[model samples]
Target: MIADTFLIVTLLAAATVRGAAPLVLAALGGLFAERSGVVDIGLEGKMLTAAFAAAATAAVTGSVWIGLVAGIAASVLFALLHGFACVTHQGNQVVSGMALNITVSGLTVVLGYAWFQEGGQTPLLAPGARFGPIELPGAAALASLPVIGPIYREVISGHNLLVYVAAAAVPIVAWLVYRTRFGLRLRAVGESPGAVDTAGVSVSATRYMALVGSGILCGLSGAYLSTAHHASFIRDMSAGKGYLALAALIFGQWRPLPTLGACLLFAFADAVQLRLQGTPLPFVGVVPVQLIQAIPYILTVALLAGVVGRAVAPRAIGVPYVKER
Candidate 1:
């Protein structure tokens, strides 16, 4: 009984990390864009488009690498378009983002029908085209060690490469946003674009660059979803994770470390729900499936309602830049 309990706990912990990986990427992407004063509500659209591109390309070429490249390219294109409308033309950021979201949601379905004729999904990828868990070197050799070996194997190792990438991003983002000159300028641009402009920086350029970075991260998240987490892209496969990422950003107060914690919190809730589903408890006979699915979203609303504290956004966020002559 004790061994079974230990095994269940370890499995749930690993699952939480898995569920949080994409959210971490998307939340970090949102952080970069918003830190540069760009409201990227279109993260959903970019992710959806990238997922389709990745799945379709992988299905065709039988190469996840090519699919990853295609996905990032597609997302970068969409990000540039958003930049064109919001940064260049000074369009309403929210409206433009929503429009992009609507456009991509429909466009993917149409393209899927035309290309693969699978209604709205791309063709299922081949074994070589999908990413699966890779057992690390020395993983087996260490299993005889004490608690550390088993914990390392179950929670820290055995995930695909993207999981490690997501884990690495936390420190990288922290350094980029807090330790670099460009990070200083990026934050300044978001808080006070006029000041950044007065300091001889191009506000549009900074924001556009931030959007590009955002695109890369979002694309990575999408590719992981289609190629690593699942073997194919399903219609609306993102399943509102993009929005959930935004909530995580909000809950984290836009900081890299805190935002990571927020993502893991949501992911942990999801893992718990997965474990609880159809399980009998002391008081509860069996947990409902719908309630299990809703746990993470319910936490989102609670967080947004000030469960922890007020989440303050950047000062000049969502405001378009107009250079003063």
Candidate 2:
């Protein structure tokens, strides 16, 4: 019984890490964009586009690397368009973002039907075409250790390459946002564009840089969704993950460490919900999976609804920069 309990706990923890991977990456993408004064509501659309691009490219070439590149390119292109609309043209950020979401939602389906003729899914990729999990060195040998062994193996290892990249990005982003000159300018621009402009820092340039990073990360998140987490793309497969990521960004107070923690909590709740599917509790008597699935959203809503604290967004966010003639 002890062994079984340990096994279940270990599995859930591993699954939580796995599930949090995309959220962390996507939330990071949104965080950077927002920090630079561009509210990126189009993350869902960009992710969906990248997922389709990756899956289709991989299917054609049977090369995951090429697919990844294609995915990033697609997402970057979309990000640029969002930048053009919200930053250059000074359009409504939320509307422009939702437009992209609607556009991709329809476009992917139309394209999918044309390409595959069997609904909005790409061809199922072979395991070789997917980003398989890596087994860390010394993990097998360390599995014999009592507590540390299982924790390390389950939580610290067994994820695909992108998971580690997302984890490592936390510290890198923290340093970039807090310790670097460009980071200081970026944060300042988000808070006070007028001050940054007076300092001779191009607000457009800084925000554009943020969008670039945002696109790359979102691309990774999308590609990982279709290629690593699953074998192919399905219509709307992003499934509002982008919004959940945004929620995490707000709930985390737009900080990297707190965002990471939020992602983990959301992922943990999701993992537990999945594990509880069709399982009966003493008084509950076999709760429905749909109800279980709602837990994360409910928690996020509670957080956003002032159960935590006022969500302090960047002051200059969603505002376009116009220079004096």
Candidate 3:
């Protein structure tokens, strides 16, 4: 009985890492665009479109890699749409992003049915077509260790390659945003596009590139959702995770490492809820399922409302640049 309890605790801790992957990845992508002076409210749409594309492509080609590529392409297309609207037509950024979200939510369902005839979802794939765990060196042996080590080895260590990529992306993006020439121009444009424009960097081009980069990361996150997490696609599966990611980014002050930590906290809350559902705890009796589900969101609201100070945004964010004659 003691062994079983110990194992359960380890598994739950590992689940926290798995759950954090998507949120961390998506939030990092959002940090990229927003820090560079563009607001990508369409992250939900980008994720949804990528999920559907990945599932459908994987089903057809019997290769998860093809599906991943397709997912990135789909996200890039939608990102471009947002870019065109905000950059060329000078449309409202919030409105444009919301429109994309609604569009993908409906369009994917409609088109999914047209192609698959399965009520808006694609057929499941065979073995070797979907993403599987990577057997890291000594992972299985490490899982036998006591306490936290087992969970880290078994649950967190064997995720798809994308999870590692997502984990690495935070630092890479953080460095790009804070330490590079491109990063400087990106922030400059977001803060004062007039200055960046005067310096001969095309404001529109920088914004467009940022949006496209955001789309690619979002696409990778979405692919991990459908292919790595569940091995299937469902309409509206993103389920406002994108918004939660945005909140995390803001909560972390738009920094990558802190934002990833915030995402993990949210994910850990969710993982703990799931782990506790069937377990018999000592002090806390079986809590209401609804209450458990609300923990992460409650934390998010409380943090935003009570603790976090006012976050600073880019000066030129959401505003189109017009050069003076």
Candidate 4:
């Protein structure tokens, strides 16, 4: 009984981490954008574009690395477009983002049907084209031990490279945001572009850089969705993960570590929902699939309703900087 209980806990923990990986990557990407005073409502669009590009490229090239690059390139292009409109033209950031989202949503489907004719999805990826789980050294040997062994083998090992990248990204982003020179400039620009401008920093440049970083991270998230997590790109594969990531960002007040916590919380809800599907309870019997699926979103709404704390955004977020003569 104890062993069975341990196995269940191990599986749940692993699922939670796997589920949280993409959210962590996307939320951190949003953190960079919002911290630099740009509201990136197009995260969903960029992620979908990247997922399609990555899957299509991998299916054709038979190389997941190449597919990852393609995904990053596609996402970066969208990010740059957002920067061009919002930063260069001084356009309405929200409008530009929504337009991009709508455009990508439709464009990907059209292109998928035109090229692959698989009903708006890329071909199923071959084994070599998708990311495969890597077993850490001694994972086999350590699996026989008690207690810690299951945790290490299941939770700490067996994930693909992107999962590790997502874990590492949190600390790296924290250091970049709080312990680096560019981070200071980025934060200053978000809080007060005028002050950053007065201090000889180009506000536009900083924000654009931040968006680029955002694009790269979002690309990773998308690539993970299609190549690492799923075998192919389906229509609207990103769903609303980008928006959830944004919510996690706001929940964490745009901080990297706290944002990670929020992501884990959502992921836990998701993992539980997956486990609870068709589960019979004392009174409920079998839970409805729709209700099971809605658990994560419901938790998101509850948290945003001030269960955690008040979330204060950057002062200059969504306000384009107009330089003084």
Candidate 5:
């Protein structure tokens, strides 16, 4: 019985990884944009748009890969729109991002209704049209372990290929942000655009590239949420996880590992909330489900309020760079 309890706890821990994947990817996307002096408040919209695109495309073409591409393309277009406003026009980043979010929120439903007439939801796909995991060389071996290994197999082994992509992206992003020349210049532009400009790096170009990278990552995250996790896209399925990712971004101080940790914390809270709905509580005797559902939001609020201090964001963040005339 003790061994059984340990196995169950390990399984929950492992499952938290899957629950955290979307937020991790989205946070990584926000990391690129924010670290490069772009405040992508529209990430929520971008994810929603991508999710809708992925589901619609998959439903029509019966190809998950095409759906993923379509989702990324759509997110890129939206991110470019934000880039045009903030980078080119020197518009207010917050206002521009809010506008984009509102635009996608409305446009997706209208277009989705027009295209598929499914009342803002897309048809579910067959198994082949959805994303699934790959069995790595040693994956089978991992599942056979006594306690911890079984938990990994049950929770992580059957996840979609995008899960691996999302996990791999953390180190890749960290390396790109810290080790590469482009990463150095990207941070320079964010920290001090004037310095970056004096160094002969194209500040505007770097910011645009960062935004585009953000688009691809967020789009991929959204596609995974739709085709890989749920197999169908609900309107506004993102449900503000983009904003949560942004919070994790600030909470982690713009670093990859810390941001992933923050994401896991939130995901764990979410998973606990879901799991609690099934059990009976002593004394309280059946707490309201809404109270349980609010756990993530409550944790987020508490972290933002109590834990965050005077953290300095990138110097050029939210400030449009202007080349000297």
Candidate 6:
């Protein structure tokens, strides 16, 4: 009984980590863009575009690395477009982001159908084309041990490479944001681009750099979704993960570690919902599928409502900087 209980707990924990990986990546990407005063409402669009690009490319090229590169490149292009409108043309940041999102939502479907003709989805990726789970060293040997063995083998091992990447990204992003020179400039630009400009820093340049980082991270998130989590890129595969990530960012007050915690909370809700589907309970009996599906979103709304008031965004976020004469 104890062993069965441990196995179930480990499985749920692993699922929670898997579900949270994409959110963590997307939220971290948003952190960089928002920290530099750019409101990136197009994270969903970028992820979608990247997912389609990665899957299509991998299906054609039979090389996952090449697909990964294509994904990053596509995301970066969209990020640059966002930067161009918001920073260079002095357009409404929100409008620009929404336009990108709307455009990608349609464009990817159209292109997918035109090229693959599989009802707006890329071909199912073969095992070689997908990001396969990697076993940690000694995972097999350690699996026979007691309590710690199951945790290490099931919870710590057997995830695809991007899962580990997402775990590593948190500390790296924290250091980049709080312990680096560029971080100083990023925070400064977000708070007061005028001050940064007065101090001889190029506000446009800093924000652009931040957007590049944002693009790379979003690319990774999208790639993970299609290549690691699912076998192919389906229409609207990103499904609102980008928005959830933004919510997590706000809930964490735009900080790295706190944002990760919020992501894990949402992921836990998601894992529980999956486990509860079709399962009978003492009082609830078999819950409705729709209600079970809504659990994560409901939790998100509740958490955001509670924290939004206390969570303050960067001062100059969404405002385009004007250089003084």
The lDDT for every candidate, in the order shown, is: 0.90, 0.89, 0.83, 0.91, 0.85, 0.91
Q: Estimate each model's TM-score.
A: 0.95, 0.95, 0.92, 0.95, 0.92, 0.95
Q: After superposition, how far is residue 195 of candidate 4 from its true place, in Å?
A: 0.1
Tens digit of per-residue lDDT, candidate 5, span 83-193: 999999999999998998998988888888787778987888788888977665556787777764666576656677888888999999999999999899889999999
> Which 10 residues in a row give candidate 5 its minimum summed lDDT?
303-312
Angstrom error of the Cα, residue 21, model 6: value is 0.7
Q: Residue-wise lDDT of candidate 3 within 304-323, one digit each (tens)?
A: 67655655677777787777
Cα RMSDs of all predictions?
Answer: 1.6, 1.6, 2.2, 1.7, 2.2, 1.8
| Per-residue lDDT of model 1, residues 1-325, tens digit only | 8878888888998999999999999899999999999998988888898899999999999999999999999998999999999999999999998998899989988999899988888988888998889898887989888777887899988999889999999999989999999899989999999999998999999999999988999999999999999999998888888888888887888999999998998888789887887788778777786786676677667766878577778999999989876
How many clashing pairs per prediction, in order?
0, 0, 0, 0, 0, 0
- Candidate 5 matches the true fold with a TM-score of 0.92
| TM-score between model 2 and native | 0.95
- The 10-residue segment with the lowest total lDDT in model 2: 291-300
The deviation in Å at residue 210 for candidate 1 is: 0.6
127-162 per-residue lDDT for model 2 (tens digits)? 888899898998899999998898888888888988
lDDT over C-alpha atoms for residue 192 of model 2: 98
lDDT by residue for model 4 over 106-178, one digit each (tens)? Answer: 9999999999999999999998999999899989899888877789899999999999999999999999999
Total backbone collisions, model 1: 0
**lDDT head-to-head 4 vs 5, winner:** 4
Candidate 2 Cα misplacement greater than 4 A, ranges: 282-288
Report the C-alpha lDDT of model 6 over 177-230, residue by residue, as the tens digit.
Answer: 999999999999999999999999999999999999999999999999998899
